[model samples]
Each structure stands twice: as structure tokens, then as C-alpha cells.
Target: MTTREIVQKLWNLCNVLRDDGITYHQYVTELTYILFLKMMKERKQEAAIPEKYCWDRLRALHGEEMYRHYRELLTHLGTEAEDELIRQIYHNASTNIGEPKNLEKIIRSIDDLDWYSAREEGLGNLYEGLLEKNASEKKSGAGQYFTPRPLINVMVKLIDPQPGERCNDPAAGTFGFMIAADQYLREKTDDYFEVPKLKPFQINQAFTGCELVQETHRLALMNARLHGIEGKIYLGDTLSSLGTQMGGMDVILTNPPFGTKRGGERPTRNDLTFVTTNKQLNFLQHIYRALKKDGKARAAVVLPDNVLFQEGDGRRVREDLMDKCNLHTILRLPTGIFYAQGVKTNVLFFNRGTNDTGNTEEVWFYDLRTNMPSFGKRNALTEEHFGDFIRAYTAEDRTQVKDPRWSRFTREEIRAKGDTLDLGLIADESLSAYENLPDPIESAEEAIGKLERAAGLLSEVVEELKAAEGGNRK
Candidate 1:
């Protein structure tokens, strides 16, 4: 079977799991545990996994015995396994399957898949497909961690990470951005054959990230390993002291979790200048500060609309970002693309300056959100949607690019607007007619008609009340 077909077949098995009360998110996690073992066996790299707990041994068993053994296997690998990665993947793992027959059915179904074809298509691609499928299911609630793949690809392409440079995602969901960067470098360097000496650093140290959620962290580890990446994927909060230590990165790309810190708590990182409960604002502070101080260090970040216009710390953070970095490009993303339906977002592209002061001269804005189709399940966002913006971004002279959606503003102009980065130059054609006021006579007539309808309903209610009162008096 092709990788897509295999992913579909595996996802379909979730229906069987639903009877056992397994959620879509939980099912993906469960599948990861089983698939890791099978994948290692297919790759002929099962030295880390104990022979008894391996895929073939587990598949040979039957009934309750098999179910019990599987539970034991999970516990042993989690705590006692010699391989650290194996332990991380299986840590605190347990079966949610209540019936032994259900367990047997799942095992049988996985074992029956065409492994040869899957290997040919790449096991990493298969696993990623499953992740994408889960994220697309709104009921799964996995979309929060998963950024749209096309968006991720576009960001990676624009950043264009080179070999031997460190790239990180502090708010990594499934390590998608890091993985895409790796793939991009590989394609550019012919799998790093052109730079044999740098291959070790590229594979073992170039990519790293931190994830807050435990299950999500586990998925990140699995995803990284499947793609042959050995970079560190830490399990901890980036807003705490952990993030304080993550500096000197050459390139950073991330979509940090939205909303304020939990329970109105502030970040524990003492190094940040402006303190706030807003997670994105704090993340913004962390990202630019985390970059290498050299003029070449750069980053691209996804942030919400509130960060653009909110006063107090939000404005302070924007000013701070501009002062320390070039703050060159802002792409206002379209609505309905993320899992949260109406939450609008933008991408900030900038490079860390050697000197902290006056790095920003001008800011270019791309109004992609205005006059764009509502992007959702039926109308998905693609790389083609980013074509015009990308050409303008990479053009030798951005000023000469004659696109209506592209515009620029000087730093002086932004300062006049109270340092708010929320600038959109495009006038949406859909709302242009509404910008003009309606005829006074027509507006008054419409208001009167609505008032008359309300008065008629009130009269009927008053008559009914009077009749009821008269009946009681009689």
C-alpha cells in the first residue's frame, strides 16, 4: 500500500478504538507507541528495543495473554529500557483498550499492513500523515499544536536555513518547522553529500526545540527520530527559566501557544525586560533575544492581531523588537485558516542586529487577509496563496514591486501611530461600498418599519394580559 493509503487504513482503525472510549488524540498517541516498534523492526534497527518487547514477539501472541504482555512491555520500556529515546516514547504509557478482543483486532490489523511499500514511501511520511489527519479533525483538539503544513513550508523556505547553523522552535508542536528545515537543507545539498563534514552537525545538532505538553513532546521525539534527527527536544515550559538558557540560535521559527499564561501567572524568566501574562508577547521577547547577536541571526514568528495593537506591554514589546531587530516584513495572514476559526494571525520576519539601537528603518506589510477567500476545510491555504508575497519579499528591490497587496512604511510613520505595527494599506473591495453612508430617507424608513413590528408584538401581549386580568376579576 502507498503511504497515504496506509495512513487512511490506520486512521480508520480509530473507529474500532472509539468503542473502547479512545479519543482521536489518544488514539494517535497509542498508535505512536505501536508504530515505533514496528517501524524500528522494518528499518532493522531494533537494538534499542528489547527483543521480547519487539514488534514480532508482540504480534505472535493471542487473547488476554497478549494484552497483558503488551501492558508489561510498555512499563518495562518506559522505565527500564537501555535506550533513552525508547524510554521517552513509552514513558507512562498504558493501554486504554478495555477488551482483549479489541486489542487483538488492532494488533492483527497493523500486522496485516503492507510494510514493504510503507518503507519504500518512508515511514516518517506515513507518521506525519497521521498527525495531519488528526489535526484536521476539529473534535480531536489537536489543531492547537499543529500549524498548517503549507504555512510551515512557506516559512521554512523564506528563512532558508543553511548547514551547520542552529535552528530551533521554542513552542514546537510536533517539530514540523524543524523537520521541514532539515528536509530543505537536505534537498539543497544533495542529502549533505556535498558537505560530508557538516552532515554530523546537521543530523545531530542543527535542529532542536522545546514542547510544553508531555504527550506532544513524546510525539515530537518520535517524529524527530523517524526523520533521523537526534537534536534535543526538551519537555518543559519555554517561558520559565528553561527558555532563559536557550540563546545563540542562528535561526528561529515558531507559532507560540496563544492566550495569556495560565491562572494570570507571569513568566518566570527573569531576563525579559517587559513582564506580562500575554503568552505571545512574552514569546516575542524570548525569540529576538534568543537569536545570535551577529547581524546574520534571524527569525520568523507567528503572532495574533492583539499583539499588533494592544497597549502597555504589547506596544513595549513591539518597540523592543524593532529596536533590536530589522523588523522588515509582516504578512497579515487570512482568517479561518487556523483551528480557532476567526483568530487572525501574522508572520513577523526580522534579523537580529549587531547593535541594539535603530536597526529598523522601514517595515513592509503584505495585506494577504483582505479581499481573500475564507480559508477553511473546503478552501484550504496553499503555497500558491503565498506566491505574490514571496516574490515581493525576495525581490532585489521591494520598492519596485507593483502589487496592490504590498506596501511599506517608514519607522517615523510607525512612531507617529504610537508604535503599533498593525498597518494594512489595502482597502477591501467587499467593504468599500459600505464605507459610504446609506441615504438618510431610506435608513429612516427601515428603522421605522422595524419599530412598527416591535409595537405590533407589544400590543398583542398587552391585550392578552388585560383579558386574563378581566377573567380573574369576574
Candidate 2:
């Protein structure tokens, strides 16, 4: 079977699981557990798995017995396995299936597939497709972790991660960035993992990441191992003081969670000069700080409009970013491409800056969002969608492009505009239709997100009012 066929066959089991009250997110996680076991059994990596709880042992059982054994196997792997990959895959893992029949059916379905052909056809694509399915289903807010693969491909392509150089995603979501970088290395270099002699760093320490959420972290680890990349992914908060270690990375790519930190709590990390409740800004601070300051480090990050325009700490963080790293390219992304509608986002691509003169002299702005078709399931984002923008991404003079969607702004010019990177030269024709409106669901989600943010701010106001009242009472 082809990758798509394998994805379809595997994904169809999600329906049977749904009847058992298993969510789309839960179904995917469960599939990862089973799929890994099947693959391990196929590869016959005996050292990786204990003999008693092997795939064959679980497959031989029936009814509740099989379900019981499978549960035990997952538990055993979670706590007892010697292989780090196996251990990570099953860490905190539990079966979501409530029925033995459903469990049996899923096992049979997976067993029936042509693994030999599917392996050759590409299991990485198959698993990623499953992840995309779970993301598009809008389960457990999986969309937040799921950066569109097309966008990922473009970012990875732009960075062009090299062998032996460290690549990382602190907010690793599904570990898509690391996986894409790995694939890029293999294809572009025609280099296998065990190629023309491997150094220790090149083999074991090539790519790494840190994820706050355990479920997504587990998925990312499984994703990495399935692709034959032994990437180090830690399970911890990336924004916390004790979060993943910073600095020394050659390339960093990430899309941190959008929204403010609850209760206006900033990270305990004293390393960040300008602290704020804004999660993206905090991640932005960490990304540049994590980069090597010797001038070779580069990064591409996805951040919301608030980072570009908001004042106070937002401005401070942006300034820090500009001074420390080259805020060279900002790609205005189209709306509806994300699950959260109306959240205008942009990708900031820049390399680390070393001198007092500043690294970004003139920042290039590409307005891909303006007048572009709303990106959604009906009109999925693809490489072709980014064709024009990719071509516009040039080392040549900005005037040479002649594309109206492209423009450039000097650092001084940006500073004159109150240092707000929300600079756009062309007014989008779509702006006029603001009153005509967006889809009802999209509009509702946008309204909810705004209301939530406003409520958070209002709480701060309430506290301030109470503090004033107490002062007057005193």
C-alpha cells in the first residue's frame, strides 16, 4: 500500500474508536502505541523490547485478555523499557479503547497492511498525514501544535540545516521542524544516517527539541524515531527558567503557543531582560538567546500580530530581538490557515547578530496575506501557494523584484514608525470587505479569542481597582 492508503486504512480505525468515547487526539496517540509495537516486531529489534510483552505475545491473545495484555505491554514499555525511544513512546501512555472488540479490530487492520511495501513507499509521510488528520479534526487544540507542513518545508528549505550543526525547536509541537530538517539533509546530501563515517554529534546529537505538553512530546519523539533520526526531545516547559538549555544552536524553527501566560505570570528565567505575560514574546526572547552569538546562528519563528504592534514589553522584546539578531524577513501569513481564525501571523527569519552596528540593516516584508484566498481544509496550504513568496525571497536589491507585494524598510525608518514592525506598504483590497464579514464559525472563534484576551486584561484592571480602593481605605 502507498502512504496515503496506509494512512486511510489506519485512520479509518479512528471511527470504531470514536464509539468508545475516544477522541480524535486520543485515537492518534493510541495508534502510535500500536503502530510502534508492530514496527518493532517487524524489525525484530529484540533488545528494544522485552520478550514477555512482545508484539507476538499481545497478538496471540483474544477478547479482554488481549486488551489486558496490551495495557500491560504499554505500561511495561513506559516504565521498564531500556530503549529510550520505546520508553518515551509509552511514557504516561494508556489505551483509550473501552472495548476489546475495537482493540482486536484495530490490531487486525494494522496487521493486514503490506508493511514491506508501505515501508519502502514511506512511513514518515504516512505518520505525518495521520498527524495532519488529527490536527485538521480540531481535536484537543492539536492545531496549535500542528504547523502546516508546507510552511515547515519552506522554513526548513530557507534555513538549509547542515550535517553536524545543531538544529532545534524549543517549542517542538509535533517535532515537524526537526523531522523536516532531517529529511532535507538525507535528500539534498544523499547521505544516509550511517554515511561516510559519522562523528558523535552528527549521529546522536544532530537535532533536539523541548515540548511542554507530554502527549505532543510523546508524538514528536515517536515521529523522530520512525524517521530513523535519534533526536533528543525533552519534556519540559520551554519558557520556564529551568526550561531547555539555551544557546549553541545553529538553526532554530518554532511556532510557540499564541496567547498570554495565565495570571500575568512571567518566566522565572532572569536571562530575559524584558519579561511579559505574552507567551510568543517570551518564546521570541528565548529563541534569540538560545542562538549562538558568534554570528552563524539563524532562526525562523511564527508569531502573532500582537508581537509586531503591542507596546511595553512587546516593544522591548522586539527591540532586543532587533539588536541581538537580524530581524531580516517577515512573511505576513494568510488568515484561516490556522485553526484559530483571524489570528494574523508572520514568520521572522533572521540570523544572529554580533556587532554594535546591528545585523538587520534593511528588513524585507512580503505581504502574502493580502488578497490571498482564505487557507482552510477546502483550500489547503501547499508548496505552490508559497511559490511567489519563495521566489521573492532574494539576496538581490529589493527594487529589482518589482513585485508590488514585496517591500523593504530600513531600521531607522522602522524606528521612526515607533518601532512597530507592523509596517505594511500596500493596503490590501480585502480590507474593504471587513464589514461584509467572514464565515460565521471563523468569526465566532475570532470573537472568542478576543473576548478571552480582553477578559484576562479586565481581571488585571479589577485587581488594580481593588488595590486603589485599599489604598484609599488606609
Model 2 regions more than 4 Å off: 192-195, 430-474
Model 1 Cα lDDT, one tens digit per residue, 397-416: 99999998999999999999
- Clash pairs (backbone) in predicted model 1: none
Residue 295 displacement in candidate 2 (angstroms): 1.7
* lDDT (C-alpha, whole model) for all candidates: 0.91, 0.83
Residues 346-464 of candidate 2 have per-residue lDDT tens digits of 99998897763477677889998877777776678899988878888854665688788888899999999888999764775555676435567666665775686689799999999
Top candidate (lDDT): 1
| Residue 1 displacement in candidate 2 (angstroms) | 2.6
